[model samples]
Target: MNTLPQWAELLVSFFIILGASFTFIGSLGLLRLPDFMARLHAPTKATTLGVGGIIIGSMLYFSLSDTLSLHELLIAIFLFLTAPISAHLLAKAGLHLELKLTDNTRDLRKKPEQYSDKDS
Candidate 1:
């Protein structure tokens, strides 16, 4: 029977705490941010990192146990790949629908004007 070194255990605990804190912060941001775009960024970025960290910690903890486990890595990879795409599509759809916010900082999806040659 092999026991994890004290240092390894401490490291794992630290990662778990860090990941939990980030996820909490993301949830708070989701509630606190005033606007939709700003709110969208908070959860998408922080939660992604938080989940990634937890998954890595789980991978480390399991890898040290002799039996190989790739489930955590696969989940993390899928999450990293999909989260951004989902956010982008949602933002694009919002812009297309001309959703207006009470306090919009800047209009990112301003339509480009078509120039005509007859305009001198």
Candidate 2:
């Protein structure tokens, strides 16, 4: 059982707390915000960042005491790589369905062809 030094422990704690805060805020946004588009922004952006921070903190904690962890690095990498792709897919589905957007939700382009993948 290795004990982390004060500085390393502090850094790890900071990252964990920051991650938790962002995750909580993102969850709140998802629940409270009206409409799918607004809801999509919350989890994709904030939750990804939150989880990344937590992963980084885990990496730091383990790396400080042991060899650098492949698990944490891989998780962070996969998360960052997938989040945007998932968000894009969800948005495309929403557009395909022509889901209603709240008035506060900024209007998408007037023309769908510009962004849509449909063939002429």
Candidate 3:
């Protein structure tokens, strides 16, 4: 078994704690937020970032412990790639169903004349 240097271990532990805290915050937001749209924001943004932190910490820990490899790299890549797409798809499905939007949601309606020629 390999032991990490003091600073590297400290950094890794910090990342892990930060990641767990963000994840907890995300879960709390999901439970306490008033509406669906508001609730969706927590997991998509906070949780993704939280997971990213955990992955980065894992990568650092493993890389320091053994021969550096791309296993953790691939997991991080896949996670960063998929989280947004999943969130977008869920939002689109909700929109297509005409689900209730939070009062704070920006009004999407706009006049056709406001569009630039490039937008037409």
Best by lDDT: 2
Question: What are the TM-scores, per candidate, against the unseen true structure?
Answer: 0.83, 0.88, 0.83
> Order of all candidates by TM-score, from best down to worst?
2, 3, 1
lDDT of each: 0.80, 0.91, 0.84
lDDT at 58, model 1: 81
Model 3 lDDT per residue over 1-120, tens place: 989899999999999999999999999999988777678899988888888888889988988889786787888889889988998998878767777766787535335466546655
Q: CA lDDT of 46 in candidate 3?
A: 88
lDDT of 1 by residue, 35-117 (tens): 77777887899988888888877877777755767989889989999999999988888777786665554664453443434
Q: Which stretches of candidate 3 lie over 4 Å from their true place?
A: 107-120
Model 2, position 103, has a per-residue lDDT of: 86
119: Cα error in model 2, Å: 18
Candidate 1 — number of clashing residue pairs? 0
Give the distance in Å from residue 60's predicted Cα in candidate 3 to where it truly belongs: 0.7
The C-alpha stretches of model 2 lying farther than 4 A from their native spots are: 109-120
